[model samples]
Target: MAKSSRKANSGAFSRRKLLQGASAGIAASLLTPSGSSWSQSAQSERGSASAQRLAAITPESLPKAWSREEIQRRWRAVRQKMKEAELDCLLVCQHHPGEMISERQDGDADIEYLTGISLPYKWVVLPIEGKVTAISTNQVKGAREEKLSQDRGIDVRIVDGPWSASIIDAMREASVAQGRIGVTDLADASRQAEGEVTYTTYDRVLKAFPQAKFQPASYLIDGVAALHSPEEIGVLEKTTQVGELGLQAMFEAARPGVVQRVVWLAMFNAMVNASGERPFSVSVRADGPGNSALNRPLEEVIRAGQVLSQECSGCVLGYGSQVNHSVVVGSPVPADWDAAAKDSLDTFEEMLAAIAPGKMVKEICAAYDRRLVARGEKPGALVIHSGGLGTLPRGGSAGAVGQIVLQAGMVFDVKPAFRLKTGGTAQFGDSVVVTENGARRLGRREMKVVKLS
Candidate 1:
């Protein structure tokens, strides 16, 4: 969910302040990877003032249980795509941070997904016939240890100066500086449609390798990345559990007159304590049924009868899972709310029925629209989007990337929403994975709106 800003009183500390202070401790505990994977060199590097500052600028590499087999599987899949595309190499890069991790300016998913390094300012040059190389703005000593622990090998280097200059060096070292190279960015046609590579980087690459031909090949990565491996599926399943825990905590904390930030704090603690990573996928808003969706949590007090609609997510490693809930503050639950909940669930089931291997994504949207049409109700945007490494393959609708075929390993955060007759929105979402037979929901809770009394 996109974040919205609101003004708040920056005054004396309260329980909210205490809770906020404790969040750093919770984050440290949650991010401390299970074993001793950090190399002594990495620790020494971080010990320096300059190195520590550089580390602060880069995204932290979370503990991922991906095996050498999984890494090899990805390499093979990407190589095959290169062969099909007749490209000599791939310049897989992420130049900007996502909206979710804007505070940290975190790295994009493609860099982390392909190579295990998760630095915000990094680039990877993968050749069809040579070695894979990574260029980082800061040293990632733990990255080497983590990859070695998994028995995976990769060449990692630091960029002393210009990003494009370092990238050009990496390209030359891989022997693809002047080859027919394919360039990819953080963009995906399904959601973030704009390319992330800066004009400066592109221009320098072109200038350095005038003979080289470069083409947009984001599809090569996106196509292969759309499907998850068995290991990936397991990680996603656990992430969903973490998301559920956060949602439950948020719901339990919401009551009449409670500040929205208080509710957000409860959710933040629950997720971080569950070994999840930021940016925690969460959105909270307390409004009447007729109001527009609020993408961020406000400091307003919760009132009786206002609906608290929120989306909670848990991210483990780099995979994230989300679940949404709409709670009525003090209820005689409105009939409109009741009807919307039932409608969302019914439409979700319909979408699930259409989520089979070889089925186009449009079929899911069609199912959603059809169900609402039959209900004679106004339909909201189909809230189903691909759930995988960093915001790739956002929701596909009948009009957007709907032709993409469904596969067994593809995951989706499906939540069918509808507008209430009185004015607000009602929806329920759960992370689900497509199976050989059909689709299975990852959440353990019952699908319904909570009526707080």
Candidate 2:
């Protein structure tokens, strides 16, 4: 992910100055604010300090993938989900780099999760009774990444000539051209907004396999992948600890006179240096003085009484865990805002307590929403959301009352950014997992507003 940017090396690198054009993650096309639906990315300025200073390339191996039996076990879980959906085979698509919300690096975890292989320009085809294949453009480019997955015992190959042609051949070889097939990125015939699959490619696939029953299978892939296995949870727990270390680094780096981006910059090496080689993603942006929620760095000099808010996460072997916080620069915290943040933390605790096997999604949502309302603060968009791959899926729609029940091993993220009586948002949260008893916190850090300066 750390390719050199020709433009970003102009002069003295000022973290705050990069805010004017720090690389923007995930354009509006891939995701709109009204809802986190798929869309495209925006044009980002090159030569940002992040691209040069905090590129997330590491040399380490924390993921000794599950054993061969375990890989088959997970594959069976995929088939079970497919059986429930009546799909004979599932075609999982990769996300455009523009679809990810990250600081500088982007990844495709859905593909990685299913095949245990993480390669770009690739597709994973999983048929009920055949070998699951990781389809890539070429063997040379992904040789290193391919070896990593091969070490874990998975089949990896390169598509000859056109990718569509290769895909058609693969399906025909498995005799699935005329059978039911599921493509995750197949947009509905109407809007058909360009996501990872362009209209031309979508039409080409349809034309190539005229009689195949192609359908959208994103829900099946996302829903089941959202639930973590025992081995997956073990990796996520390690990811959470790495995130805690990054947050701790951010806390230690925050002080009077420190640049806004310094907090984020500090996390770059601190995470990699400390964690060795766990797959991790870190993003920290300050909102005090010259910095907005969307912009990072801002070169804004930190002063007393300003708050630094951020959404930082990391993945151990591509199993993601995240945490959000708003740290105060100095004392005499605003009572109204403090109360709201405290209530946010309190509601988060309520959410963790409420998540248990067999509980309806709406039941847990309402249980926490009511607690926030009683405290005179409306619960934010998502009280709880699901975790998978490298992305955090907001479990269905936040505040959408529903009967979707929580089962053991389901993992979700909790981030509360509520309207404050004193103004602005009071944001804080962390990741958790649903076990037989209740939601267990994955992060190692304490749930309290930090006082750095």
Candidate 3:
């Protein structure tokens, strides 16, 4: 996350003086909104600042961008696996077939990773041994395909009307006569499935394609999820920086008599203005006691001496990074607050230390439980405390918060939190990469509670 500092206050000013001071600050090159202009000297200074910020992000430090050769190799691997599993072909849907709101479209991550196309109104049919074809809405013809397939050189077929005919035609062109065709859609089997052919989409694929087979494209999804290239890391780092800016704004807005939504709006505006991006999710909550730590920010009025927790995540180029921090308004923390924050920090450090490539997730969870027990605290049942970080495309469960084995190239948001018996809680999280030696924190700033008195 990015470092934050307080904006200097120009106090005891009359209305006229306040306006004059504002104009003077702009004229004197003391302040400039992000991406704004000033005198030539100020512009040069801002340019230097930009350069320094860019220099901090080492190009060689992040993972490599996926090459066409690499993508093709992985695709061939999946095709070979499909052949071994006796599956005819895999059908990946771009949008959800069901009209139900809960059954939304498939994640764009998997489709983009595979075809370099990241639209919701598209579909792809990757046969075991044939050309890959995409069926998309006619309106998106030329533009969407051109942008998505700029690198991979894949052509997307435009569908004028219903998707069923377009899908069937593509399947026939791939020579999928009577074999089972794997599909990502669960509701649209008859639309894509042909006579004497088994529909291999989701659970029913096995039953639909008895002679053929049904296999999920999970391995392909997992490969993309685990793989983190250099460009992706840069985007994620920027996202973390945006999150930090939001956190800082939250701290600044957390004062006595400020409504919760007002604080949220301030933080939201700060982040959007700073990065020109919106947070994936932003929530704020403040109360005295008997509240869940994950409380959503409501329209409740803020009172003096209340603890406010602000959690935010920014979406940059589709990837996201999240951070949460608690702030005190108009009062110093109680005696127990310091100890709880310290213990939370300690637990976070322990978790970070335990994170390494090749470590079993189960072992890490066990270690967390042991540490909490040693601290004379009840270890809440936490299945997974970390995960591979990236844009969540589709196929996997939405918000799949769970434990998985650590890999060398994977990035994780390692968060270890504990609730105090006194009805208060302490929490902190940071983004880290699992390297061959150990984990590295992307946000180098120290984690601490901000007490605004």
Candidate 4:
């Protein structure tokens, strides 16, 4: 189990600006007639801003595109899931960043994983049989849509109004206006409870398609998305390599007299230079002798005997892996601190041993708890959530969902968090994938407490 209190960094690609684009689209809807498209003037304003920003990076310069085979595999999996759910189509919303808890930095992982595009306020209409159309609010002269079509080889439709109206238009075009439609925002385990769609948007959708029966179908995608393909696993390995570099940079920069913020920036620069995109949360806990809380870098200088408890991850192509490590600045190491730290690593190893294919979710959690007890330590919350595209299943244990049989190709972020009687804390874990034999670590860092003299 890996537990964390993650913070969000909107990324260098201003997610707030993307939200503003969504707002602009919504505001444009008010200016237009109830059943009509956006006004010409309103479109020009929105398009210009997006176009200018997109001009900096050419399609050739973009990160390696997903293979056609991988796309087909994902489509087949999702369609099979849809078939099981007895749905005519899926209205998968791809909107503003940080909208979902698990997807705070990376925008909608479902769309990004499926279409390989990271644009905001877009809605994808995937029919049971036919072309998949992605409706975008910021398309000028079909240039943006055309670019997407050329890149992802999917149909791109330019919507001139809010996502609610746009989705209705797309559904009608796909001939699923009155069919069984599955909306993504309904309920995603842990990430979303009542769904991510606002009341206004859902109400508008309900009013437009009164005949269509809508159901919460986020699980349909969530289940399929959790199992990564071979291509995705390769990408995850590369992403973990980049995250390791960031961790190394953090360790090098952390020393007596250096501000915690400077150390964090050092890690950020190293990861970005290594082709990293979204940088997830990094907590630098150097409070005192018994540090248990995670926090952002402050102006306080690092003291000689202070213990630094840190957790961080670096994102690449919308994929990231986490690493939690701790260090003592100048050690005459405390025996109790060293013992607790080693026990955390031991607990993590035991948990990993129990994470093979066909294992039950409760079994893994039970193994984790038993190991802590064997060490004469009180068991604490452990997090063993899926790590893929970001918005996958999340929970204190295997998942918020009930007993699930572990399968090969499932990736998990397993961390065993330990809070000792001395008020000190230690969390040891890494990103791992379930294989036929056992779990494999994606982290390159050594799992142990470091003592710096």
* Maximum-lDDT candidate: 1
lDDT scores for all predictions? 0.65, 0.57, 0.52, 0.61
Q: 3 or 4: which has the higher lDDT?
A: 4
Cα TM-score of candidate 4: 0.78
Tens digits of per-residue lDDT for model 4, 197-244? 677878898898889899888877778977887777766655665556
Cα lDDT of model 2 by residue, 3-96, tens digit: 1111212344322223212322211111112211101110011122322222232223344343445556677888898888778888766753
- What candidate 1 gets wrong by more than 4 Å, as runs, is 1-64, 95-105, 139-151, 186-192, 288-295, 374-380
Q: Which model is ahead, 1 or 4, in terms of lDDT?
A: 1
Clashes in model 4: which pairs?
A: 1-383, 1-415, 2-383, 2-415
Residue pairs with clashing backbones, model 2: 8-47, 16-298, 16-299, 27-41, 27-42, 29-39, 29-40, 30-38, 30-39, 30-40
TM-score of each: 0.80, 0.76, 0.67, 0.78
Q: Clash pairs of candidate 1?
A: 289-423, 289-424, 290-423, 290-424
* lDDT computed for candidate 2: 0.57
Local accuracy of candidate 3 as per-residue lDDT tens digits, 75-172: 67668767776778877664322222111123444455566433444667788876777666755554523444544545477777756666667766
Best-fitting candidate, scored by TM-score: 1
By TM-score, highest first, what's the ranking? 1, 4, 2, 3
